[model samples]
Target: MISSNKLIAAISLAVVGGFVAEFAKPQMPEGSNPGYMTLISAAVGLCVGWRIMGPRAGRDSSIGLGMLGVVSLVFWGLAVFGTIEMLRLAMRRRFDEPVEALEMIVTIALKYGQYLAATPVYITLAVGIVISGYVTNFAYRRWG
Candidate 1:
């Protein structure tokens, strides 16, 4: 069922994703083309906010919900991008073994994480998620 809380959560996280993507863009290796990175991250954020954080919005403390949102966003974002990179590499026959290809997904994600950690992306995400959780909680209380 649709709810104001879910909608708010989705929108907030989507913005957070876009911000993080923009922040991370400059940190990417030189000569990398990050076409649609912001859009993809926002979409991922919308889905995760709706599916994961939305339902739990009112049930948990705002802080707890915010932390959950941040964790979910980071995990899904990394997983999606990592898998995409892995697939690109696989198509180029960069991995001789299937297992190595699968491993590359994690390796790529960790590398991405390193870049994110080195920047202000984490701070932006944390602040955004926390505010999102608060707003979602308020919506739940006001509308439900």
Candidate 2:
């Protein structure tokens, strides 16, 4: 059993987490879309949450599900985008200067400070999902 307030808070945190990922994109590389990574991260969170919460529960569980869904989508999207970017960088054939590629990667990494900085937020989103589920469960059993 979950409570309405806990459910709402969970959903809100998940959505805000997704939005935060989007907002952090300007700090990413030029012509790179970080929406995918954010989506993926969110999705991962949601799936984990859903698995933990299970189905056939009350309306509060539904809220948890909703939050999980959104967050999972964001997480998956972000991961896909990140992987593609890495692949593109890896595929560069300018092998004439191996060090150049490595240097380029380092430079790119430095430029995307937001991407690095946002790791904590992404981690938090996942943690939040789990926390929300537990909180909802607690509320469902104890609050009412």
Candidate 3:
């Protein structure tokens, strides 16, 4: 029994993340839309938090779910954008120079981490992340 308000906030944040992705236009081909990745990531994160925490019927659980949903947004943003950028780098062979297969893999791993650590990932979710936190904080304080 997920809280309706929390669900709505989660969904809205996903949508906001999508808009960010669409505008960011990092590695996507011209006219390509990468928004769906953010959408899917947010949905998956919500599901994951719901599944692990179980029904949100209980007061404690509802609060937990609310907080989890907010945190999940961060994870989703990082993972979805990071993977997309990493894959783009790999596909374009954007490394400084050609390398052995094993080296390529290692370099990709490192770059992936760097992408995750980059500012744009957080920027994409900037306002939305704050909104999520406020939503959850409200949920916990008001109802949970």
Which candidate ranks first by TM-score, i.e. highest?
Answer: 1
Please provide, for model 1 over 1-144, each residue's C-alpha lDDT reduced to its tens digit, 9 standing for 90 to 100. 999888888888888989999999899899999888899999999998899988887899988887888789989999999999999999999999999999999999998887687448868977986798899899889995
As a whole number from 0 to 100, the lDDT of residue 60 in candidate 3 is 46
Each candidate structure's TM-score, on Cα atoms with residue i matched to residue i, is 0.94, 0.38, 0.44
* Each model's backbone clash number: 0, 30, 0
Q: Please state the error at residue 8 of candidate 1 in Å.
A: 1.1
C-alpha lDDT of all candidate models, in order:
0.88, 0.51, 0.51
Q: Give the least accurate 10-residue stretch of model 1, judged by summed lDDT.
A: 113-122
Tens-place lDDT digits, model 2, residues 15-128: 545565665666566896554656654554444344433342245564475455445544444454444455577687634566765556545544443464667656655565
Better of 1 and 3 by TM-score: 1
lDDT of 3 at 94: 70
All candidates in order of lDDT, best leading: 1, 3, 2
Error of 3 at 47 (Å): 3.2
Instruction: Name the runs in model 1 displaced over 4 angstroms.
Output: none
lDDT of 2 at 123: 63
RMSD of candidate 1 to true structure, Å: 1.2
